[model samples]
Target: MRDPAPRAVTSICRALAEQIERGLLTAGSQLPAERKLSEVFDTTRITLREALGQLESQGLIYREERRGWFVSPARVAYNPLVRTHFHAMVAEQGRVPATEVLSARLMPASADICELLQLPGLSSVYQIRRARRIDGRLVLYVEHYLNPAYFPGILAFDLTRSLTELYASEYDIRYGRVRFDMVPTALHNEAATALKVAVGGPALRIVRVNRDQHGRLIDCDMEFWRHDALHVSVEVPD
Candidate 1:
C-alpha cells in the first residue's frame, strides 16, 4: 500500500492555507507551537513540519531561526527601473521602513568589489553593512562598498538613512546610472544570521552598481532579501 503521510501533509497544508487566506491568521503573526499544531492536526510532527514547509515554499508563511513560523505579509512590489531609494519605495507602498547599520569601516577592496566599482588593485573602499525592516519585520541585509575617493569623512554621517539622499546632500552628487543583477540563492552565513533565518534558506540576491552624475562609478550594493518579501514589477514605455 502507498504511504498515507503525504495525504496527511496535504490535508494539513490546505487547512492552514485556508486559515491564512481567510485572515484567521493575520500577517506577521506567529503560528502556534509545533507540538500544539501537530496535536491539533492529529498527525505526526514530521507530517506537520512537511506541511509547514510546503506553505513556506508557497510564500504563505516563513520561519525564523530559533523563532517559530509566521504568516507572511503581502509582498512589496519592486521596480528596478525606478530611481527611488529603499525607504521611499517601501513607504510609497504604505509600509513603515526602518534601517539599522550593522558595521561601517574603511577596508581594502576585494577583487570582486574592485571589479564592480572599477577601482585599481589595492585601493581601499568604505564598506557599510545594514539590515532593513518593513513594518518591524527584518527583510533585507545589504552590504555597500563605496569608492573612498568620492566621499571623504562619510563614516561620520548616520549610516542608517538612505545613502542616495546622503550622497546628493553631502557630496552634491546624485545617482545617474545603475545596473542590476539578480539571482535566486541560498542564504549565506552573515545574511542568514542577520535576517534570523536558517542557513541555506531560499533568498533573492540583487547586486547593484551605481554611477554618479559625472559618469564615475561610485558604489556597489549587494542585497540579500527574503525570497517571499518581494514582487518584481516593471513598466516599459513605448
Candidate 2:
C-alpha cells in the first residue's frame, strides 16, 4: 500500500539526478523555473520541491538567497592545525582560489581586541576585511585585526596578498602557537551579503589567533564560511 504520487516523485528525482551525474547540469548551474520543471514532470509544485529538498540534503544541490537552486561544487578540505595560508591551501586542493580586499583601515582596538592581543586601552590596530572565493563562489569572509605596533606602516603595503609571506619576508615572524575557536552559527549583515547567503543561514565561524616565536600575539582573524562549501579536517598532535 504505497502512495502512487510518491512513486512518481522518486522517478522525477531519479531523472533529474541522472542529468546532474551525467554532466547535463553542471556544477553551479541554476535549475529551470519551478513552473517549467513542474510541467515537465507533470507533478505538483509541492511534489517537485520535496524531490529537490532531498537533493539538497544529499549535497547534490544548494540554494542562494533570492536565487534559485544550483548544483553544489566540490567542498574544500581545510586542516586547521596546519600552518598553511588561505590562498595556498585552496590551491593545493586543486581548486582556483581568489581573494578580494574589501576594506582596510587603522582603527583603535576595542576592549576585547586589546585583551586578546595583550595591549593597552585604545591601542591602534589595522583592521583588514577580505573575501575568499573558490571556483567563482564566495565561501568565506574574514576580518583581520593586527597589532600595528609590530609592523609600522603596514598599511602602505598590499593587503590583498598573503600576510604570512609578508610577515616572514619583512618581519621574520613565523607562527609559534596558533589557537582556534570554531562554532556553528547563523550568518548576518555584511557577512551574509558577501557570501550571498540569507541572514539566518547556517555557517561556520572560526576565530584564530596567531603568535610569533616570542609568544607575542601578532594578529587574530575572524572567518565566516558557508557550511556547505567547506570541510575541516585536522590531526591533533600529542
Q: Which 10-residue window in model 1 sums to the lowest lDDT? A: 1-10
**Model 1 misplaced regions, further than 4 Å:** 1-3
Report the alpha-carbon TM-score of model 1 versus the true structure: 0.97
Q: Scored by CA lDDT, what does every candidate get?
A: 0.94, 0.86
Off by over 4 Å in 2: 1-24, 41-58, 236-238
For 138-218, candidate 2 gives per-residue lDDT tens digits of 889999999987888877888778999888888888878998999988888989888877687677899998899899999
All candidates: CA RMSD in angstroms? 1.6, 3.2
User: What TM-score against the true fold does each predicted structure earn?
Assistant: 0.97, 0.84
User: Per-residue lDDT of 93-203 in model 1, one digit per residue for the tens?
Assistant: 999999999999999999999899988899999999999999999999999999989999999999999999999999998998999999999999999999999999999
- Which predicted model would earn the best lDDT? 1
- Residue 226 C-alpha lDDT in model 1: 96
Model 2 score (lDDT): 0.86
Give model 1's clash tally: 0
